[model samples]
Target: MNFDEQTVLVTGAGRGLGTSIARAFAHQGARVVVNYRASAVSAEQLAAEIGGLAVQADITVAEEMDALFTAAEQHFGTTVTTVVNNALADFSFNGDARSKADSISWEQFDAQFQGTVRGALTTTQRALPGMRTAGFGRIINVGTNLFQNPVVPYHDYTASKAALLSLTRTLAADLGVDGITVNMVSGGLLRTTDASAATPEAVFDLIAASTPLQRVVTPAEFADALLFFASPWSRSVTGQNLVVDGGLVKD
Candidate 1:
C-alpha cells in the first residue's frame, strides 16, 4: 500500500472531482494513470503536470477497460495497484431540471447504472488479473451521501451509487483472499465541481448552513478519503463506505 510504489488508475479523471482525486494520488508519489472518456485536453494537461499517463477509455465498455489497463501497464512498466471508480455519466446536479418521481423514466436510471455500476464492474474485472498476480490491489469506488440523506432525492444518481456500494462490499469479500481491498468514499454535493456548477447559489448556501463544518465540502477534501482506502493506513479496512460530507450526513 505504499503509494510510492503503486500505479493508480482513476476513471473519469479528465475533469471535476476525478481530477482532484488524480492529483491527490500523484502528490502521494503514486504512478497515476488519468483515465478519461472525453476531455482529452484537460486529461493530457493533468498527466503532464503530474508526470502521469493519460489513457482514454469508456469505463462501461469491457474492451476499452481492457485497453486502458494495457496502456497503463505498458507505459508505467507495472500494473495498476489502485483503481478509483470516479467517473460519472453526463449529469448536472440541477435539482430544478431533474425528473420527478412520477415522471422519471427507467432509461434515466439505466444510464446511471451503466455509468456507475457497469463501469466499475468492467474496470475491476479488467484490473483483477494484475492484482491477483501481484497479491495487492485497492479498489476505491466513488459514491454519494444521498443514499443516507437523500436531501434532493437525485433518484437515478443515488440509486446507481447505492448499487455500486453493494458491488464494493461483495467484491471485497471475493477479493480479500487475493490481497485486494474494495471500499467506497461517498460525498455530499461538492462546492463547485462541473456537475455541481448547475446547483443554485441558494441551495449551496443552504447545504453549507446545514453541515457541522458550515461549508460545502471541496473536491480535494473529499478526495483525501480515497487516499486512506488506498494507503497502508486502511490495510484492515474493506467493504466499508466512508461518508465525507462535512458532517452533513451523520451516518
Candidate 2:
C-alpha cells in the first residue's frame, strides 16, 4: 500500500512486531513515528534505518502519549493519520512461567489492561480531533487469538486483548462519521518476536501443525493485514477483527 500522503504512529515500535510494523509503513512511503517506552536505543536505530521519527512515550500515561503525537506532527509537518497500537507489556512468552487463574493476581490483570486497553483509549483520544478535522483516520489495534483458544491459559494477556477488541468495535461505531475506521488484526504465536522469544520450539511446531497452512505467522505477514485496514480498500470496513494466524482460528 502507498502511504505517501499519510503519517503513521506505531507504539512500542522499538523492536519485535512493532519494529516490523514500523518498517512496513515506512517502506510503503508513510512518514512513520516510532514510539517506544524504554527501548530507546533499539527504537532510535529502527527509526534511523527507516527514516522515521523515534519518539518515546509510555502509552499508559496520557501526558506522555500526547507528547508523542505532538512530536510526530512537528517532525512530519502533518498529523498522524494512522495509528497501530502494537505496544505490549513486558512479557516473556514462556508458557511455564504464566500464572494460571488460581495463582494470578488482580495486579497482573490490571497491568495488562492499562497497557492494552487504556493505552489505546488515550492515543485514540489524542488523535481524534486531527482525524475528525481531516475526515480521515485509521486505528489498528494489535490483538491475539489466545482469547479464542487459550491453549496456554495466558489469562492476563488474553483478557486485555479482549478488552481492546471491545474498544476497537465501539470506537469504530462512534468515529465512522468522521471517516475514521477502527479495526483489529489478531494473530497467534508470532514466530520470534521479543515477547515470544521464550516460546519453545516444540510449541511452535505444535501450533504450526494445527494450522491449515502448517506454520506460525510472521510479524511482517501480520502487518499486511493491519495495512489493509488503513488502506482505501477498507474504507467501509470497521468494528471488525481480522485474524491473521495462518488460519489457526477462523472467526
Candidate 3:
C-alpha cells in the first residue's frame, strides 16, 4: 500500500503495538505522528528511525489532546487524513482479576474505560475538524478479542472494549457522509512489551492450540488489518470490527 504523502497520527507510539503500527505506516511513505504520554525517549527514537514526528500528550486531558493535534498540524500542514486510536492507560496486566463481580470496584472499571474508550473519544473528536476539512479520513480503533472469549475475566478491560466496538459502529454511521470511516481491529492474547506480560505460557499455548492457525497474533500482524481499513481499498467499508485472532473466536 502506497500512502505516499498522507499523514497518520498514532497515539501511544512509544512502544509495543503502537510503535509497530506507526512504523508500518511510515514504511508505506505516510508521514506519521508518534504520540506518547510518558515515553518520550522511545517515541523520539522511533520518530527519528521512521523520519516521523514525535508528539507528547496525555489523551485523557483535553488540553494535552489539543496540544497533540496542534503539533501534528504544525509538522504535517493541517491535513491529517488518518488516525489510529491505540492509546490506553495502564489497565491491562494489572493482575487484578477477582472471581466475583462485586470485587470489581467502580473506580477500577471507570479508569479502564476512561483510558481506552474515553481517550479514543477525545482524540477522534479533536481530529474530526481537520479530517472534515480534508474530506477524507480513516479512524481505526485498536480493540481486544477478549470481548469474544473472556477466559481470565478482565471485567473492566473487557467491558471497555465492548463499548469501543459499539462506538466504532456508531461513528461509522455518523461519519460516513463526511468521507471519514471508523473501524476496529481486535486481537487476541498478543505477547508484547507491556500489555500481555501477565499472560502465562500455558494460557498462550492453550489459546494457540485452540485457534485454527495454531498461533497467537502479533502486533505487526494486527497492524496489517488496521492498514487495510486505512487504505483506499477499504473506502466503501466502515463500522466494522476485523478480528485478527487466528480463528480463535470464529462464531
Candidate 4:
C-alpha cells in the first residue's frame, strides 16, 4: 500500500528514536499516530508539528493498547495499517552500569521481556484484525545488533531483543497468509537517543571507529530502514532482520 494511504502507529514516539521514526513517516505523507507511555508534552508538540495524532498508552497493557488503536482509528477515520514496536522499558546503554552475566537477576530479564516481547505481542495482536481486514499491514519491531555482536553483553536487554527477533520471524511466517508482513530493524549504538545518551563519548567514538561507515548511526538513519518495510518496495521482504549499524555486525 502507498504510505499516504496508511495510518502508522509508532509506540514510544514522544521522544528519542521513536520521535525520529514518527517524523519520517509523516514526511512520507502517512497519517502518523505518535504513541507514548509518557512524554506527553514532547509527543503533543511532535504531533502538532507533523499534523498527526498523539495518544498515550502503555504498550504492555492490553487495555491501554486497545484504547490506543481505537483513538487512532477514530481520529484518522482509518484503522492503523502499520505498527512500529519501538517502545522499551527505561534503560540506559552504560556498559559499566549494566548487570553482568553472573550478577543479572531474573527480575531484570522479566522487566525487559515485559517491555520488549509482551509490548510487541499486544500491539501485534491488536493490529492484526485491521490488517487482515485491509489485506495489507506492516509490523516493524525495533531491535539491537547486540544479539549478534554482544559488544557490551547487556545480558537482560540483549536476551529480550533476541526473543523479539524470534517473535518477528515467527509472526511473519504465520501472518503472511493473511497479507500481513512482520520484520525487525536492528541497530547498533545510535549516535544520540535517550537510551544511548548514557553512553560515554569514548564508547561512541569506539563504535564509530569500528563500523565501516566510520560514524555512529543516527536515529534518522535507523528509522529510514523502517520505512522500507512499510512501503510497497518491501512487500516480499518479511521475516528478516535488517541491521542498520553501518556494517558493524554483518548478519
Relative to the true structure, how large is the alpha-carbon lDDT of every model?
0.94, 0.90, 0.86, 0.95
Task: Enumerate clash totals for all models, in the order shown.
Answer: 0, 0, 0, 0
Model 4 misplaced stretches (Cα beyond 4 Å): none
How well does candidate 2 match the true structure in TM-score terms?
0.98
Model 2 whole-model lDDT (C-alpha atoms): 0.90
Candidate 4, 91-153: lDDT as tens digits: 999998999878889999999999999999999999999999999999999999998999999
How far residue 147's Cα lies from its native spot in candidate 3, in Å, is: 1.4
**Estimated TM-score per prediction?**
0.99, 0.98, 0.95, 0.99
lDDT of 3 at 153: 80
Model 3 C-alpha lDDT per residue in residues 111-221, reported as the tens digit of each score: 889988889999999889988988888999998888888867888888998999999999999999999999999988886647777666787788889989888888888
Error of 1 at 206 (Å): 0.7
Best to worst by lDDT, what's the order?
Answer: 4, 1, 2, 3
Off by over 4 Å in 1: none
Superposed model 2: Cα runs more than 4 Å off: none
**Candidate 2 lDDT tens digits, 1-251:** 24888899999999899999998888888889999988999999999899999998999888997888888888888888999999998777899889987889999999999989988898889999888878899999999998998879898999999999999999999999888999999999998899999999999999999999999999998887788887878988999999999998877
For model 1 the local lDDT of residue 56 reads 90
Where's the lowest-lDDT run of ten residues in candidate 3? 91-100
Q: After superposition, how far is residue 110 of candidate 1 from its true place, in Å?
A: 0.5
Candidate 3 versus truth, CA RMSD in Å, comes to 1.7
